[model samples]
Structure formats: C-alpha cells, structure tokens
Target: MDIKLWQAIIYIVLALIIGAAAGFFIARAWFKNYLKKNPPVNERMIREMMRQMGRTPSEKQVRQVMSSMNQVK
Candidate 1:
C-alpha cells in the first residue's frame, strides 16, 4: 500500500539523520580526548615567548600558537 511505502521511507530518512548526528558527536568527542592526551607544546612555547616579548597575549594569539604547534611533527 502507498501508506506503508511512505512510512518506510520516513523511517529510513530518520534513521539516516540519527546515524549522521551520532557519528558527528562521536568524532568530536574522540578528537577532544586526543587533543587532551597530546597537549599543545608549541602553544606553551609561544606563550613563554610572548611573555619574553613583554606583550599582553590575547586569546587569538594563543589559538594561533596552538594552530602552529599542531603543524609541528
């Protein structure tokens, strides 16, 4: 019946959406945990460098330092 077919389609769509959302959340959590385990050393170095530079470090600067640090081997 047409009604049954539509119901099946709706269920499939809902399942796909739920699966995608769950995948995104899992990936985000895993990445956050990985970063916590591997602390950003470059950012720490940059902060020390900034202190030596006698300049007030901003949040943006700290992020930049972390980004650059992530690029290192």
Candidate 2:
C-alpha cells in the first residue's frame, strides 16, 4: 500500500473513535437530564411502594418522600 493510503486509514480510524466518544457522552448527558425533569417515580408509585411494605401512605408522608427525593437531585 502507498503512504497516502496508510495516512487516510489512520485518519478515518481516529475520526471514528472521536465521534463515538463524543456521541456516548452526549447521549449519557441527555438521558440524565431527561430523567431529572421527568422522575421515574411519582406520588402514586410512592404510595404503592409503601403499600407493598405493608403501610398505607398518607398525603403528608408522600409529600415528605417527594421532597426528600427532589432534594437529592
């Protein structure tokens, strides 16, 4: 193979690597932001969890749990 062909191959490989890394980070950041804005667990889910644990959650209890969870974010 010619020297030019080798150089072209190296450049293409480098570009692919850089693109993959950048895309990975961007996708990860977007997912994190999406989850933050739309939390996976809501009031109903929390109530269900408490019920599973054998306790019926009250409005105050649910609100407290929500506040604590949001504070962590």
Candidate 3:
C-alpha cells in the first residue's frame, strides 16, 4: 500500500513538471509573435536616440540603422 501511494505521488509530480515545461514554451512562442506584430522600437525611436547622442540623423543613416537592427533580430 505504501509503494502504491508513492507511485501515485510520482505520477502527479511528473505530470506537473511536464505541464510547466509545455507552458513555458507556449508562452515564449506567444511573446515572440506578439513582439513581431507590435515592435517596440521604430525608425523614429532610432533617430531620436541618435539625436540624443549629439548626432543628427540623415534619412539614409536612419535607414541603414533600421536595416541592421532588423537583420540582427
């Protein structure tokens, strides 16, 4: 009877662990999709950032930075 009880506990623990693992992956995928759909940073932000650093951004410079940023992702 003791062995049976321990076996049941192990099964429940295993199920809980598996469920947590699945949730982590699912949440990660959802977050990735959300970020892709609504990017936090845009060209304007990059331009502003450059300006803050004492550099005036030309359109071409902004475009290059934007392309490189996207490529890094």
- Give the per-residue Cα lDDT of candidate 2 at 64: 100
- What C-alpha lDDT does candidate 2 achieve relative to the native structure? 0.96
How far is each candidate from the true structure, as Cα RMSD in Å? 7.7, 5.4, 4.6
TM-score of each: 0.56, 0.57, 0.57
Residue by residue across 29-63, what tens digits does model 1's lDDT show? 99999999986566667778899999879889899
Best by TM-score: 2
Q: Candidate 3, which segments miss by more than 4 Å at Cα?
A: 45-73
In angstroms, the error of model 2 at 61 is 15
Off by over 4 Å in 2: 42-73
**Cα lDDT computed for each candidate against the true fold:** 0.87, 0.96, 0.96
Predict model 1's lDDT versus the native: 0.87
- For 1-73, candidate 2 gives per-residue lDDT tens digits of 6999999999999999999999999999999999999978899999999999999999999999999999999
> Weakest 10 consecutive residues, lDDT, candidate 1?
39-48
**Candidate number achieving the greatest lDDT relative to the actual structure:** 2
Q: What are the per-residue Cα lDDT tens digits for candidate 3 across 1-73?
A: 9999999999999999999999999999999999999978899999999999999999999999989988999
Worst 10 residues of 2 by lDDT: 36-45
Which has the better lDDT: candidate 1, or candidate 3? Answer: 3
